[model samples]
Target chain A: MQPRLVRLTVWAAVLGLAACKPKEAPAPPRPDPADAAQRAAAAFVHCVEGGNAACIRTGLPHGAFDAFVLLGWLATGSPVAILDALSRELVAHSDPRTVQGRFVREVERLSGPLRGAECSPVGAQELAPMVTQLAQATKARLEAIGMASADMMRVVEGLAAEAAEGLEGAFLVRMSCKREPYQLYLAMVPEGPRYSAIGLMPYLPRFLGGDEAQIDAAQALRSKSLGISGAAAPVPDGTVDRYLPIPMEEF
Target chain B: MFASFASFLLAVSVGLSSGAPDPQARATAAGYEQLRGFATVLVTHLNRALGTEHLPPFVGAPVTPGLIVTADPSRVQLFDRFAVPLSAGRVSPPEPSPECASKCPKILFDTFRRWWFELGVESRTHAVEVPDVVLIGAHRDLPAQTLTQIAYAASESRPIQPPRLMLLTHGGPAGVRGIPFYLVRPGGLTLPPNSAALGLTVTIEPGRFVVTAAARSFGRTLSATSVPELVAILKDVHRHHPNKAAIVYRFSGDVSVGNFVATYAAVREEFPVAVLGDDEPITIP
Candidate 1:
């Protein structure tokens, strides 16, 4: 009886400890969205570095706000990372709290197409908060759909330096910039009900010989060097041109 | 020199500390191929259920499908017409419309959805907080009559105020009897404006004996009153038009076929109507 009583006391003590410990149901695990956002931010920066901003803006026009957000995301990775990025982009004359406080405002007010068109795009003053939000939002959005962040990361990771014809409404427009030897091909994407800018018009720096025929020929040749067909618009001169049907081959 | 070193160190540290891998280094031939598959999947996911089905290869800028008004949701259909002419990647030479035909609920929605997803479109205002990429489809000056008509439409849509909406014309086929194409925006917005908005692009399909036109009426959430007014306008247009069909094409950003069929049938009792949910492609109905 004494040994059995001792065993029962030990079991009760263990049960009491189990009750004291907080037991949480395992939520379906989610990859930190912060990671995915950071990657997207990194990819945008890498793409920007590889291509010209003017050229990219020609496609995205109003500077890639998401990319800038990612840029901030990368800069202010955390409180620790913010020490460097925020310190540099921070308005020296302004209070640090004020600079930090500015993030509460929308990213659009800072550097969206509206401001870009109004000739008042985001500047150094708003940079700190913008990037911080970019990072946070990216993380939050991806986190919401446990799989969305991963999938988008894969998409961004897979992005090539060609026209962004991934979505259904993307197509190529050959713009005759009036007497320019090399016409331009605008990789136009759908902007709401209407279509958006001359986003993906790639320009080749090399002087083309007289024999060079097409508008995006140089870039086409370069893309060929990379072993790829020219993206959506490669200057169709005649009345009729070829259009790859929607859901274009991914690459 | 000390400042330079510190700057260099900061730059290097930032580069190193940033959590992303060297994407440039991985951007290779094989990388593109791997990316291609992933891109398809990612696009599919972004498009949601709309991505699952295969799209028939037709060669035209997006156009509206023939409309058939029916009470039955099952009877609703949408389709496409391809190999049409494209100018600046837009359907060209359309205003109040010059021509007609049938096929594809897509072209307009293709334009609408394309705009909906790609552009950082906010509500009616530029105030939508998004990465805005405003569409400035190469502008075509509106004929005075078309502008007058637009003013009338704006007044009808917003009865309390002077019409402040604007219009831009886009893609149509080459030849006689081309359709009238126009997209409505805020009065001051221009092609390549600072930002983009999700508005209604009304395309009066080139032919008759079908619906007269299509408009991007709503996005995501459909309303009972959202498209019926436009439907009435199309009927009014048909009354003036020589060729008349019984249907008009309408599309929204994120609505399903079943739900739209159910909703419209309940709300719109006047016409024998058919609807296209998000499940299928623009079929040749």
Candidate 2:
């Protein structure tokens, strides 16, 4: 009886040990680098689309103006040359009482709040009114800077209205805008991981061509898109079509 | 007894099969996809009437997405993948020259000031000298004759010293056109010892400068507010090495050319200087 009892206890102990043994946990999947980038890009597009002033301003990367200057440098020879030219232009109308000074002050007044505002999302209704106010103020300021042409202000107003309309439905894609003299390649690629939608500002003109030549170039760039969108069939190349009216399943 | 042991093995297999996926990781991935979906709903309508001519496509964060970049004009393409690295917008390293073979050491040439440059080596023990033949990593946009012209100019101006200066650059020669000539002056610049290089970034922020060194021997960054102050700091940082240290200058895109030229002049007035062109590598010790 004692031997049989000992055998029962040993078998019970083996069963208990087997039940309690922990399984090997699988290694966590490494997050895709593209996913994070795409997310950052999406956040930026949403900020712009929604007119979240704070998001837009905060999203403006540190060297935002630097790209502007460098793009100017491409045409003006050097950053110093552009600065000097600007200085000369400013000094020509140095009087704060002059139209130039008022224009500068007005621009400063309009832009200061946007620049210093906290990083937060604003309501949809809030942005459209603010943008219209900005557009009107901008038109007024242009007149101060001697751009008071009826045609010019009309064009500006027309453009502003069109812009508001364009924001109604816009999808964003990541295009690597590289200029000549490769270092400027950083023109759109930020220094660190954070994505800034404004880097695309320089390329927008090219993307939205004004002339036949500009249109051709824009078409060429669009042809290079990775056509993942099902709306348009993929070019013989593997890249997806440029435009997608509907959301993709990959998302 | 054998049947009991077999039952224990079956129990263990059941435990392995029951392991559940971590909830947190799945949630994070799902959140990323949702945000991506929200941003990607509608394509920016092609409306040229919107006066968006000045605006290019929206700038995107750096992403390669399995695309290959070509060598000449160095544009990114979808097909024809290769093993070249993509960093800070630079494509490939200078194709290793036959002359360099294993011994080739790269140096950063201020292609802006073709005459000025800093020397690098394959290793610590490598001997130092100026090579008569320097290779310019030209963009395909650059004419082929540009290489011959640069080589001829370099050969013509070989310094009267041993360790012949072979001036091969890791940066493309075309991009230097935008750099202000005065910002990187050619005069009074010295050839630093082959030991280590120091990095200095001139920024758009008024009076702010960031000094950096990548070596464990040196700490990462030193900030300075003025040219005189920057010079003093550079002097103090490299005091031990004295003239042995080289300065690699990186300019913020928005940095006023005047400020950059001032800081660059002050530093180069004392140490050898090379402006970083096209994502060139810098060394520090």
Candidate 3:
């Protein structure tokens, strides 16, 4: 079933945290993995909430931020992360108005168990102006290219109820892009006072497009037919189809 | 250059070679005339065996350059390793009729041995270069294995060769893993059959060096005899960084050279084929 994209000011506690900005409070230099995961998720959610373009440079884990750029290409083929590619022509000549405001309203809301997104290296300082130009001047271009719009961006979408999950690790935060053929899985590993979001692509560049329906149907059938209620249903086609696990007959 | 095949019909069906060396093979080293004929047959047969339908210098492995290959078979396809056919010309066979059927093993072994001599290989009387490695598939008997190694050593530049005597296992018969040799099963003479032995692959895991048998077409689990020498070689080569041909021979129930040919072709059909050394070949479940 196509999930309804409901806009809400407040959501279930389990829905996860958003921009809980505390003014002038710098996160600790080295946060624990648990703390880092919360901090990373909040940062990503906060940035997406306001189309916080700065997240690309300093907000998310440097590795995750870099991955966003790569994933953007696979997700939309729109060059949403093209500004961060450091290309001379696109960097200097591309407009920057659409992305600049994303830097604002990015106050860190560090409530809940999620913590410690402060340890990882923020992306290049030089990339700020370039990102600003892309976010603002090229807002439509960004959307056309599958860049996450400010409104559609959220840390956890649909109570984790409406959306299909790809991975769940002790420190992983994964969400599928409902509109496009992509999903991102980020991880929080031991590194700083906070968890490092290095190697975030568990389901690296997972494409959720044409194959999504087949995969979902197969999953649903397994969950329903097998009477597996509340349990995680394994993808039916492990060896064959990404969405469908091997046929029952093959068993 | 068209590859001339030294056709040796396996005199025994899946049975070992008859205990007789080919007179033609013996006479091959006798003079320059015989040398030319041997060279042609060796090159032509190897080129096809090695699947070098096109590569110019389609010199099959172990046999170095400086040797010539000819094919008197009019239907002979002159090609290189790349599968590209080369220029074809009518050439004469060295003799009136193809040499009579002789011991197939001795022919192949003798052919390789003659090439070494023609290549001016260094040889010692009492001590032939030691064969630190034993090719299980190449020889069914022990003595011929040693003798084959005698000529084979010139092909390889080994320092202190094993004594020309009984073949000793790295471990015991059960433990002995001879050098990695591919047991090319009876089929795969045509194309990459559902089962064609390609080569051996070694993957180093956490603490162990894992060796796997590779084939173009993989389905069934590959089986290999476990010998200590193979294991020793795997342990030895694991010390190092990791890592086909249609010769159709019609045969009946007769245990003639066809059986040996088909069998030898099955294993040696593809040289450099890796036999599981450190461990027995296991079927991937």
Candidate 4:
């Protein structure tokens, strides 16, 4: 009876301890969608600014990257019908993963011009800060000239008016990199819960000659440099002028 | 001789330490030449940075004469264009200088008055032309018309269409504001076609149809208010235009890339013969 009574007391103690245990902390609240989107978008810019290839890839989803590349390629004067047909053929043989890899490589190549550049991801609403930067630049430049106070004010006022007029109705998310003449404006679009950036025009410089000729030549040269062959479409000159098309829905 | 040498050394040392202004710079600050001097200096710096022998001269397009708008958030002013006051503050005029010695301020005022007058006249006249290179002040809000006005003031001087119209915003990287380095113009364009080539102007607006016309040619006037309606008209023209006609785009700097890309894409779709007109080769940033 003593042994049995002792066992019963121990079981009661165990039950009391179990009942007294605190409830587990509630699951962390789901991240807000807007904040998530902003963070996701900014991460891409951060990676690019950091010049991290791996980080860039991680930020870029397959679909978003493809859409960007296709848009830029088609913009280079490729006839829609021709590209539509060529895109199908290119997609047939190319792997989406491999296409993304090449794109990251292309970004790595083009980022040379923008190396050490101060790039900022500007939202549609957050342009005031940048505008202020521009104002400072203007003031310093004008001040350096040693103009009269009134004259300087006049110039600054006019510029301020112009800036006001020009930016009134624009709604865009841009990654503006401070290059020589002002800044390089690259557009970004929201994809699902995140955002993706477009950066390709810097590859097609003007010195290569006429529009069609230059585009073809640059693409062919780019392809050769990348050792890309089977997938890229070859122009009449026996050089590949097109990149492998990764099929993405209209973005 | 030793005393004189010592004094000369002292002056040289003082000048070097103080970074004495050059004669040209000193002269540039005073008189009517100041306006022209500013232009020369700005252009020289732009050319040096651009690696080009000549970029079109900068024509200042201040909104008001004699008054300068600075980006001072403290004081706000209500312009005719805005209902709310702008954060850009005004510079108070200095003590009246009736007997002005430099004459630079007078010249600046006169030049600004003329530009403002011309701009008003141009707007009233509904001139469709844009300038080759316009330098709007270094403010952040690029309202559609301001940066584009850079070329209009210049257009008053040179009526001819330049090979390229480069629309840029002021304020560049630190210490380079005087030089207009921010290029705001759209890119990926072919060289300007011959003057004789037929041209049509297409204005870009987001998610809306645009009506455009061939203002360059009389009797070739075509109209459609929306982009789709205009695209239909251009399709007919492209199908039949004997000479490969070129399409010139006229838009405020505020036009989005999506709108532009869509418009360009639509034009490219119909005009497989390719009659797009622009001054420079595709020199995008």
Best by TM-score: 4
Candidate 1, B-chain TM: 0.18
Every candidate's DockQ is 0.02, 0.01, 0.00, 0.01
Candidate 1 residues lying further than 4 Å off, grouped into runs, are: A1-125, A143-251, B1-33, B36-285
lDDT of each: 0.26, 0.30, 0.26, 0.34
Q: What TM-score quantifies how close candidate 1 is to the native fold?
A: 0.21
TM-score on alpha carbons, each prediction: 0.21, 0.20, 0.16, 0.23
Measured with C-alpha atoms, the lDDT of residue A179 in candidate 1 is 26
10 residues in a row with least lDDT, candidate 3 chain A: A155-164
Per-residue accuracy of model 1 over B209-266 as CA lDDT, tens digit each: 1232222222222212445544565444435432322232233332322222332333
True contacts kept of 4: 0.00
Query: Interface RMSD value for candidate 1, one decimal?
Result: 20.2
A8-86 in candidate 2: lDDT tens per residue?
9999999999889997799988654344444555464344335455543333222222212222222212111121122
| Model 2 chain A lDDT-worst window of ten | A242-251
Error of 4 at B285 (Å): 41
TM-score of chain B of each: 0.18, 0.31, 0.19, 0.30
C-alpha RMSD in Å of predicted model 2 compared with the true structure: 32.0
- Cα lDDT of model 3 by residue, B1-285, tens digit: 001100111111111112223446634643122211222333333444332222221112332112222221122211110111112211122221122121222223333333222111111101122122222212221122222222222222212221111111122223211222221121111212332223344332222333334443322332223323335544443233232221111112222221222233333323223221112122222
lDDT (10s digit) by residue, model 3, range A105-137:
212221111122222221111122223222232
Better of 1 and 4 by TM-score: 4
In angstroms, the error of model 1 at B239 is 44
Lowest-scoring 10 consecutive residues by lDDT in candidate 3 chain B? B1-10
